[model samples]
Target: MLPPIYTWLKASNAVKAIIGNTPRAYRPGDAPQDVTQPYVTWALVAGVPDNQLSSTPPSDRYTVQVDCWHTTDKGVEDLAKAVRNAIEPNAHLTAIPVNNRDPETKLYRIALQFDVLQTR
Candidate 1:
């Protein structure tokens, strides 16, 4: 079974509007060099399957982390709020957003996570 986060983000009008000309948000390891300035990146931090019955396919619960980054805090905050609003609309996800500046790059970012459960 496939997780819905990828499809959801790809189809989200809110996210699309906020990202502007940026490319599709990508997983951490796959981000390209041009993935910069007012962009988003995310990864499924961890996942586990549950509720197996007599060797049946197990349900899945995943922790996904999303990062919104920009040279200034304005864009980061806007993008973060957009992402939160978009994800929160889905009743299944519980979203927590936190903000901090990256010490090295000096970029402002909002880091958030979604707790997702998938049962098949």
Candidate 2:
């Protein structure tokens, strides 16, 4: 099954308000070069099937990384909060792997990781 990060985030009206319409949320390498800030990008970083002793695995666990970016620190933080509120109920937030400003671009980024269990 397809990792549900994209679908779940896009389905949130709160996320849409922050990032605008379709295409604001993107997979790595898919966002346009001139894409606006205060957007989000996500990727499935790892996965493993839930092994069972006697039957086929019933679910799979995935770790997804979500990054929120904006030119201003407050803007990026707001976007990150919106993202967490949108998805935290369905998935466990494993960690905040990155919270920094890119030196070259001067963009604020907050990267969050979530552990999601999906039924196979």
Measured by TM-score, the strongest candidate is 2
lDDT of 2 by residue, 1-120 (tens): 747777777888888888986738888898889888778989999999999999999999999999999999999998999899889988999999999999988999999999999898
**Residue lDDT tens for model 1, 1-120:** 545655666567777887763445777777677665667788787888885668865578888888888788888888877777766655244555658899987889888888777787
Estimate the TM-score of every prediction: 0.79, 0.93
Q: Considering only N, C-alpha and C atoms within 3 Å, which residue pairs clash in candidate 2?
A: none
Q: What does the lDDT read for residue 118 in candidate 1? A: 79
Off by over 4 Å in 1: 21-23, 91-98
- In model 2, the Cα lDDT at residue 59 comes to 95
What's the TM for model 1?
0.79
Worst 10 residues of 2 by lDDT: 1-10
